[model samples]
Target: MSQIVVLDTNVLLHDPQAIFAYPKDEIVIPAIVLEEIDSKKRLADELGRNARSVSRLLDKIKEEGKLHSGIKLPNGSIIRVELNHRNFTQVQDLFGEITNDHRIIAVAMNYHVEQQALPEQERKQVVLVSKDVLMRIKADVLGLPAKDYISDPHLQADDRYNGYFTLHVHPSIIDEFYTYRYLMVHNLGLRHQLNPHEFVILKDELGTTKSALLKVNANATKLEPLFLSNDPVWGITARNAQQRMALELLMNDEIPLVTLTGKAGTGKTLLALAAGLLKVEDEHKYKKLLIARPVVPMGKDIGYLPGEKEEKLRPWMQPIYDNLEYLFDTKKSGDIDKILMGLGSIHVEALTYIRGRSIPGQFIIIDEAQNLTSHEIKTIVSRVGEGSKIVLVGDPEQIDHPYLDSMSNGLTYVVERFKQEGISGHIALEKGERSKLAQLAADLL
Candidate 1:
């Protein structure tokens, strides 16, 4: 039996095409949802973009028939724009406000009540779907069934990581870590599941042997990587059987793009920056080093800042500056800027101008990439020229784009789409290396 689904304002604001997502099911867009979208259509940013997109979609659907009655979708599902009715009076009595949220609740409540009046066997189940947590709770209080809309197909729990593994080995594996770079350990008779780029710490079971870090290389076709780096990079070391596995992926220059996603203080940006610096500055493998990030306002924009382009970009780029300063240990801001500028090899350009330009033979780091739309991300990646390495780092859980979420954000989209490609790599850092307080807040708060 087809279900009756009432979408809230947030659903349309999050995804404009949500009306057609439920094929064969009756989808109803409350009049209040249209009012909310109309109000937001004049604003700027993703919310406004979604509002306008939803408006256009609704208008296009109107060609089929008047929305006040109903329209049959391409998949044969019925869609309608609900009209105001006595439902408002009951909702007002419960919610006691003429707010858009209250009106959406009223629509769902009325539909659910009407469904209940019919025989249980004949009535379609009325479900109010919303992205807003509070709105879902409100629906429950009004005796209407509600749920969070999970339209994005790729969204998974925060703990999801495709290329990772954990291993515990004896500390004596240090010698093997240095010599072989990988250990098969066939006779040891131990088997531990490992991900492509995961790390393992080996402690000596007999004596107080210092723990040796080992990485499981992603593409170690020749021999298992057991060799340990003289110094650990990104706090992950290669020890024991997985050492070879980790190195194969980390040092595999074949992979052009490497994305590290994690919550705040999880070392995603720091580790990528360090790796880029090592490859470009120390290794001299790439011709240039470039960094860029989206210019998203925290809560709101300061309108247009009266200044040059760089001045306008300063506020959003401040975090990047802080990272560079810390990485270079530069005391003065000018010192870091001077070094970055003097090294004609390094260029820090705004993402706005990266569309038409073709960047090649360079190491690119795009930080806080979660704010970008999928279209924007495609443009950025398409600009990469031959022999170019790009790293996109962001936390999906902390997205600011109104039209995106943990699953639909550009960062997650890229990760999911490119995971199978041989030329791309990804890592989800779990440990928070910033501070005890930062880690606590990221996990608890």
Candidate 2:
């Protein structure tokens, strides 16, 4: 039987290419969904950009045939603009509000009823695709099949990659790794080869309490010891194996891109900030240290807040400011602010203003990256000019974006996409070193 996939407005806004995503099945866009897209196309944000993109895609399809009637796409799928299924009587009792969500669900219900009216042999599967959780629940309550649009396939928890693993090696191999300072990759003895720049914790197979931490080279050729410096970055030392590996990647100029993932109090932001300060102030490796994070938890527009750009962003960027204050060890009120005002090397920017600019000779740090989409991260990373490094740090499990999660967020997406690349390095911090209470909360809570 053929299938009809009804898409919600948020799905298209999240990924404009969701139309062509169902290449093997028929696609439907409720008339109310078009209204939602039209409402968002005028805004000056990523959502607006996606709304315009989806409009262009639908316009292109219009040239092939009438969209009101089913148009055949080259991918053997029929795309249709659903105009007649606007009735909400079927779900008025279940969902009292006749909002856009209700209208969208009503369209799905109409299609499902139509499909059920057909003979059993000729019935088609009708499913509603949405990013909204409540909408999916409502669809289920209304006896309709609803699914989330999985844009990146390898985002499930079971399929997610941690970029590091424990390998049981003979005690002799551990001694050889320390004596020769390198070991063969073949010693891993895995069913599949590990990714380049992957980290490993080599433990004794005999459980003799012998262990060593090593990193795989870019070519996946051999295991080399981490080239970490003895001195700390900005008087902050690594507390664990993962933090040490993270510092190794952060302080290295050879790798231009690095991703660090950890729960709260894992020192992701503190370490990235320390490395940026050292590179910008002590070592003079870059011209400036640029720090940015998406203001997603708050409303999108900064105009709603009072004062100039810096003052307006102060409330939202307090976390970054707090980290800076700690690094500078400033006790007096506004001491860090005075320092930031005098210093031209360190800059903190809202994620909004970083667009459409070439950043060069700077150590850029993007915090709370898990709240951003894959496209948003791409736009930020592509802005890196020559002689620049970009570090994305976030706890994917604690996302603020409505449509994003631990797996599908840009932080996880970047880690998965660039794990094998030579220019990139990643570390997933498992243990939280914030404090006794913080670590306990992270684990037990």
Candidate 3:
């Protein structure tokens, strides 16, 4: 039997083109979903942009045929808008409130009931696809099959790319690497292909303690020793091997895109900031340093607090300021602000206002990139003009977005998608340099 996929408003908002995702199955967009999408069309955020995108797509496709009955898509799927199946009695008891979620589930439940009455051979499985966890649980309680809208299946926690791996070889290979600064990829005789700019630790297969730290050259043909791996950036130095690898990628101007992922206290922000300052201030490589981060709140909204745009963002951007204060090691209050004002080249803007920007000749650092969706990140990266580089630094495991996870967030998405690209480099830092207590909390708590 074929399947009938019911999409929620969040699914469309998460991926505006999700209607084409299931080419072999019929897709049903609940009428309530249209209402929800309409409400979000004026959000002035990612969700609003997505709602508009969905509206435009639906508008274009509906011209083919009426959406209520069915619209035959080119992908061999039947798309329809569900207007008659919103029987609230079908799901009212499962969920107490008559919220939008309840209405969406009502449509799915009515479809399931109608399909059940048909012959077993003719009944199509009705499934709810959403990004909400509690909504999925509620649907399951109502005897409906629900799932997450996972675009990529290989982004699971265990299957993720860590940017570096240990290659155990004979002692002579290690000695040969030491004798010659660079070793050919064919000479290494590795089982798996190494990605461009990937880090490696050539270790001896025998129990002997011999290893060398190297990175894949841009061509992915040779393992070259770290060139700018140990250099201190603005008085900050790497305290570990992974951090050193991250530094190598950050300092390399040839690689235009970089990704750094780790847990809290891993110094991802500090390292990226230090590198940006070095490139923009000391080296004069770019015209300025542009740093932006998502304004996702942790606990509660500070809407009642009075302030302008800058003051309103203080609570959200405080973490960035804290890192700057420590990097400057200022002895007096507001000294970091004075220094930033004097620089005139460092702009720490909010991520909300990054749209329609054509950034060029700048060092761009996006902090907490995990909260951004794949589409949102794509929008930001596409703004990079010539002579500009973008560094995405975030801890995937620390995502706070309602619809994102370590496996599905934009940071991990970019890390996997760009792993093999010659213009990008990635590093996953495990060590936490903040403090022993913080590291312990990150690991144990």
Candidate 4:
């Protein structure tokens, strides 16, 4: 049976194209939800962009038919605007409030009641879809079916690809890998399929220390030796196997996109910056090194603090500057700035200014990428032009975006979507290589 899906304002703001997500089902828009979207359409952020998109979508749909009655969607769904459900007495009796959320709930409740009055075979399931946790709880309290809008149905944080795996094999296979530098994947008799560029640690079947690090080739048919580097990059060397795997991906010009995910002290940013510098300055593979990060506030907007754009961004971008200073080995206060000014090959800016610009022949690193929505990440990636490499580094467990979590954030989304592509690579750093105190805090605290 077809079901009625009532969308909340937050769902539209989260994804403007959500109206078409459900095929062959009825989509109902509460009158109050449109009002809330209209109020947010003027803001200067991702929310405003999404709101305007929703407005355009609704306007286009309006041309099809009258929304008050019902409009046939391209996916065989029926969309209608519930303007007559403005009576909020039911919600007022339940929560004693006339807020927009209550009004939306009242619309769903009214529809549900009307549907229940029909014969059992003629009744359709009335469900409320929202991104707000509290709203879903309230719908449950009022005996209404509600669900969170999930953009990626198959994603789970615990099941994310860790970029590498360990397989215990016969000791002779490890010796053959060292001697020949390649092994046929079919000979391993593996149970799980290996993704392209995925790392593998071959240990002896006896559980001894005899091992070799290998990466699956792009064809997934052969295991090749890792490109291990002994030289220091900007005075930093790989501290662990995960870091080495990340460096291999970052320095490879063939791989246009790389994702590095880990905890706070796992050196994701440092490794990305170091490889970007090596490619830009030493190899001269690109014109410049550009580092940009989302300017997400921890608690409140940085605009509330008094200053100009640069001044306000200093606090949020300080972590980026700190990594640069360490790479440059700046002793004095202004040494890092002087080095950056003299080289004139490195640019640091907020992610807000990167849209609609074609970035070419540059190495770009986006830090704190977990705070970005999937759409925001798409906008950023779409800006990459010819001969440019983009690295997205973040700790998914430390997202600041209100609507994004570990499984749904842009960084994880990109990792999952691009893992199969030959030009993309991902590594989830497991060890914290910072100072012992910082590592301890990350683990225990």
Q: Model 4: residues >4 Å from true position, as ranges?
A: 87-90, 116-119, 299-305
User: How accurate locally, in lDDT, is each candidate?
Assistant: 0.73, 0.89, 0.90, 0.90
Cα-based RMSD of candidate 2: 1.7
lDDT (Cα, tens digit) per residue for candidate 3, span 94-138:
566799889888889889999999999899999999999998999
* Candidate scoring better on lDDT of 1 and 2: 2
- The window of 10 residues in a row where model 2 has the poorest summed lDDT is 297-306
Model 2 TM-score?
0.96
lDDT of 1 by residue, 255-320 (tens): 787777778987666666666777787788898888888877766563577688877787877777
TM-scores of the candidates in the order shown: 0.80, 0.96, 0.94, 0.92
Residue pairs in clash, model 2: none
Q: Provide the global lDDT of candidate 4 against the true structure.
A: 0.90
Q: Candidate 4: TM-score?
A: 0.92
Query: What is candidate 3's CA lDDT for residue 110?
Result: 87
User: Whole-model lDDT for model 2 versus the true structure?
Assistant: 0.89
Error of 1 at 403 (Å): 4.6
What would the per-residue lDDT of candidate 2 be over residues 386-443, giving only the tens digit for each residue? 9999999999889888777777788888988898899999988888887989999998
lDDT value for model 1? 0.73
Q: Which stretches of candidate 2 lie over 4 Å from their true place?
A: 299-301
Best-matching candidate per lDDT: 4
